[model samples]
Target: MNMSWKGVMPAMTTKFTDDDRLDLKMFEVNLKAQMKAGVDALILGGSLGEASTLLEEEKSVLTRAAVDMVDGKIPIVVNIAEQATKAAMNAAETAEQDGASGLMILPPMRYKADDRETVTYFQEIAKSTSLPIMIYNNPVDYKIHVTLEMFEELLKYDNIQAVKESTRDTTNITRLINRFGDRLKILGGVDTLALECLVMGADGWVAGLVCAFPEETVAIYRLVKAGRIDEAAAIFRWFLPLLELDINPKLVQNIKLAEVATGIGTENVRAPRLPLAGEERAQVLSIIENGMKTRPKLPDYLNL
Candidate 1:
């Protein structure tokens, strides 16, 4: 599938079994739900997907699975988070070979690279593959900020086409537009600010909570694009509490629990990371349960 790099593209969580093996069964179930809800692409092994815990070969396996499963119906994008430029490049090349339609790459992990080193890192990875790249720009969490000036330097690479805008600042979307016009696509990376970013003319959303509430997430994008602000805002208001779950530090476990509640996924995560428990689990369940009870009846936005 050709990646348009637009619309709702989920940063999906990697599902695991009781023994921590890849739960491709549940993973495919979530993929079908995302496609059925009208997402444009699937991003695998992201921060939400627990990229750090996954082995390189495991990522390739997931990529291959998604590519074969989607079978050109939608693009499958693999996330690349490595400490070295060579490793990141290798991951990019491997993803391309494994049939990934695109890549979402974070800055050099563990060690924060300077402006020049960071640009070099992305530039080398861009040169390593023919796949389109979406730079994961989340300085708020990642520490290393890919500034607009750095972007100007990166514009030299044609394959570096878009940004997963998770800086937590909505103005960055407008700044990207004002500066680059249509040269670079901006996909909202933060779930809570997704609607605002779309309304501000962002081309897409790299969403988190969509794993559990695909319909609600896609509805906001479709309604906003269709110029139905009032309708979109109504759903957004109802979805705000659930959306907040994506912004927390334990977002992976939180959203997985949501998936369990929605009957679409399991709550098993890899070691070092466990399922939500005690009062924390109860609080998150309360939010998910309440949201499910009040789940809005979505319009046929796909037809629009």
Candidate 2:
């Protein structure tokens, strides 16, 4: 599964010790469970992995754990988003050396770019790695939207194979699919929007919710692939609300909660970010507990 650009690839949470060190065992358990559930890819060191909260060393530890568990059964793509090209390149190189099958580059943080810098940024990262690169174009979260022209330019890099379109706008997915088509892998980066994205010709999901519900999410993708759009839509109905919650401000916390509530992993996260607590925590747990109640549990999710 070299650089799989399709199906449910969960943005895995980077587990942390109470002292804020990387929890390698928890990470390994999560990765193994996801693979057993048949996820198409393991997206580690990503938003849900809380990439911004991690030090380079911690990310390295997490990446190593993921690649080891996946064992090349599926593509292992890590998100490497640093403000400077060198830092991003280091992360990319480390992931590649550690056996990652691909890289997903988020725009540099804190100072999301206008058009020119955005194009240059991707070009620099693309130049640094031999691994297949997936550009993460999430303007809402990063305030940096790589335009269609920018994508066309990035397309020149043989290794710049995909774009995780997290724009939350189906129209943009349709626009990109119309213009680029098979030239680029158009992945749905948001879980709530996956079906709409698929209908608009997006090839797959770089999902956050899949960490908690891998089998269900993969089932949706398989249905879509089998041309059972109605069945896929049926699954989406149970999934979309939780997926929509993931797009909310509490996304990171909620995703961790989904993992914790369902016993796939812990909700422990590092600071600058904090775990959900008080009523906020209760509400998120309630959502996971309540929603998961109606359907039979998705395999790999711990049963109540």
Candidate 3:
């Protein structure tokens, strides 16, 4: 499958049963909804998907389920976040065999590798699998930045094709375009910066809020790319509060809550992580409710 890598792709969250087992039914439901809403791709086992906590078997199950659910409607990319190069390589190979079309790889977790080590880690994984790779560069949460210089070296591989830009530095979008030109397809990895990044020449958006409000998310990307800034801005303004939820440390809980509110999925998470409660839950609910009540109407062209 040839993905354009130039539109809205949600870094989907993993759904769990009440017993915390992989909720394959709800997972398929969410995947179907995203496809129906016309998202460009489905990314499973991302940080948003609780990849850190998932067992190897669980990741394979999610990948296989996504591939089965999407069936060729869109590409399914699995995220690989491992501490060791060989582990990352094994994960990449497994994803490919499980029918994933691509991989989004982060640098070594726990111990932040230096620039050279980071480059080596990615290259080894790329060499191990034929699947296309998107280097995840989120310094804020992951703590290791895939610097421009490092990217220059890493992009030499044929399979290392794209970058998920989440440095939270808006200017880095322009810098990426200037430095790499068309060698790397840059996807906006932050929710709040989606429109700005698109306007600044980002090829696509790897969104978080889209897991809840897919139509609105795709509408914003389409409108902005179509040069309808005012229309896109209207949606963005209405979406800002909800999009803000994506940046919080408790984003998994917040987004899962939004999913439940929207009738898509549940708020059940795994061990060491619990559902939102008390005042915190109420505050997030307020923001989501306010957004829903005042949701912006899409233009006729959007047809949502």
Candidate 4:
């Protein structure tokens, strides 16, 4: 399947059993819900999907399950975040074999590679896989920014085709468009910045809050792209509070809590990561509850 990479793609959270195993059943439930809500694609095992904690074999299962569940309704892309060049290549190969439609790759994990090293790392992985790649460029969290010059170097590779732009510098979105134009598809990576990025011509959004509110997320994207800026802004104003949850350091727990509150999944996460608790938990729940109580009604066109 050829994915346009020009609309909403949820950076889905990995659903876990109460005892911390991959819950394929509930995962299918969530994927189906996103599809029913009109999401354009599904990206699994991203930072939002808890990729760092997941085992290699678990990623395979998740990839294959997503391919099966989506069944070509939308493209399923797997995220590869590894420390070694060879390991990243192997993961990319594995994702392709597992039937993933594409791959979202971060630079070498842990060690901050210089621009030369980052270019080489991405080049090596892109050479190894037939899957289309979306370079994950968030210097804030990943510590290695894929600068414009580095992207200029990377643009030589045909498959290094997209970017998950989360530099927190919205200006960089316009810069990317000015520099790369049609060569690279830009997907807004920060939930809080999705509206601004889209307004500034980001091709799509790799959204986190969509896990909890798929329809609203899709509605915002559609309305914005359709030139209904005022309608989109109204929903975005209401969404900003919940969307802020996606940028927190504890985003996985925060988003999962919202998922549980919204009745799509659970707040259960693996060890080293626990469910939200105490005052933080209360505060998060209050935000979600308040948003739910005063949710905006979908426009008549979107109601379809």
RMSD of each: 0.7, 3.1, 1.2, 1.1
Cα lDDT for residue 139, model 2? 88
lDDT of 1 at 216: 91
The local lDDT score (0 to 100) that residue 160 gets in candidate 3 is 92
Which lDDT tens digits does candidate 2 get at residues 28-100?
Answer: 8778788877778878777777777787777777777777777667888888878887888888889888878
- Candidate 3 per-residue lDDT, tens place, 1-304, comes to 7756778999999999999899999988888888888899989899889988999999988888888788788999889999889899999889989999988999999998888898998989988989898999999888999999999889889889999999989999999999989989999999999989998999999999999999999999888888998899989999999999998989999999999988899999987889999999999999999988998888754552
Rank candidates by lDDT, best first.
1, 4, 3, 2
CA lDDT, candidate 1, residue 170: 97
> Which stretches in model 1 have alpha-carbon errors above 4 Å?
none
CA lDDT, candidate 2, residue 169: 83
| Residue 66 accuracy (lDDT) in model 4 | 89
lDDT of 2: 0.81
Give the higher-lDDT candidate: 1 or 3: 1
**Per-prediction TM-score to the true structure, in the order listed:** 0.99, 0.93, 0.97, 0.98
Give the Å error, residue 39, model 2.
1.0
Give stretches of model 3 more than 4 Å off: 301-304
Native-structure RMSD, model 1: 0.7
- Clashes (N, CA, C under 3 Å) per candidate: 0, 0, 0, 0
lDDT of 3 at 291: 89
